[model samples]
Target: MRYDIPIWKKSNLTLDEAAAYTGVGVCKLREMSNDEDCEFVLWIGSKRLLKRKKLDEYIEDMYSI
Candidate 1:
């Protein structure tokens, strides 16, 4: 018998979550969030929340070489 698993959807993510997704530590993520060169990251109030699509795009852009 096969079991069906439910898919989870994430709209917004905390700094920690974004860090894990990018394989970077929270401290580094914070630094990237502040860096003007990193356009993929966005700040929501005091918290840094990364859009899922944007993060993916950033990763692809980084690995294009």
Candidate 2:
């Protein structure tokens, strides 16, 4: 079976917003970022930002059923 993944185009999101969108606890998301497991996270001027495109890609790559 094949599945089509939706493409997201938003450039960035706050950590809290990403957590809410992904339904993952903020603490866990932070841990993932710290461990370098957050493929969607980027550092912008010392602030961490999440790319909506990357987050959607991560979900497609890791959670798509």
Candidate 3:
């Protein structure tokens, strides 16, 4: 069966989904994910995903992007 999970409920998010959820923009999200100090980036081969909970925490802790 296929799951119909929402972006907010997901464990990880694509750049587009994250952009929509966080209002951070896809290019910016990609840039942020490329940072070595970033804690929420997950790589599956050439694809990058963001851990949603960690992203939320990161954003919450940050004063600015």
Candidate 4:
């Protein structure tokens, strides 16, 4: 079996990059990062990064509901 991944999902993404890639807006992405239940967000020092794969999974889960 084989799987294919989008180019954007090949690495971690900063908040702004995530916004552009996911089209979810910067403010909402920030809110999701602060929300305790959001599992796709990661914070390092003062910088926030989103795991591209996790963000894709999260959006998929949301729409499956």
For candidate 2, write residues 1-65 as lDDT tens digits.
97544324347777777776778777876776775666778997789888887777777787432
For this target, which candidate reaches the highest lDDT against the unseen true structure?
3
Residue 6 error, candidate 1, Å: 9.5
lDDT by candidate, in order shown: 0.65, 0.71, 0.94, 0.80
lDDT of 1 at 8: 22
Ranking by TM-score: 3, 4, 2, 1
lDDT (tens digit, per residue) of candidate 3 on 1-65: 99999998999999999999999999989989998888999999998999999999999999999
Q: How far is 43's C-alpha from truth in model 2 (Å)? A: 0.7
Candidate 4 residues lying further than 4 Å off, grouped into runs, are: 1-10
Name the Cα RMSD for model 3.
1.0
2 or 4, which is superior by TM-score?
Answer: 4
Per-model TM values vs. the true structure: 0.62, 0.64, 0.92, 0.75
Stretches of candidate 1 above 4 Å error? 1-8, 36-38, 63-65
Clashes of each: 0, 0, 0, 0
Per-residue lDDT of 1-65 in model 4, one digit per residue for the tens? 87676547557788888888988988888887887777887778878888888998988878532
Question: lDDT for model 3, on a 0 to 1 scale?
Answer: 0.94
| Tens digit per residue, CA lDDT, model 1, 14-55 | 777766666767887676667766666667677677666666
Instruction: Give the number of the best model, judged by TM-score.
Output: 3
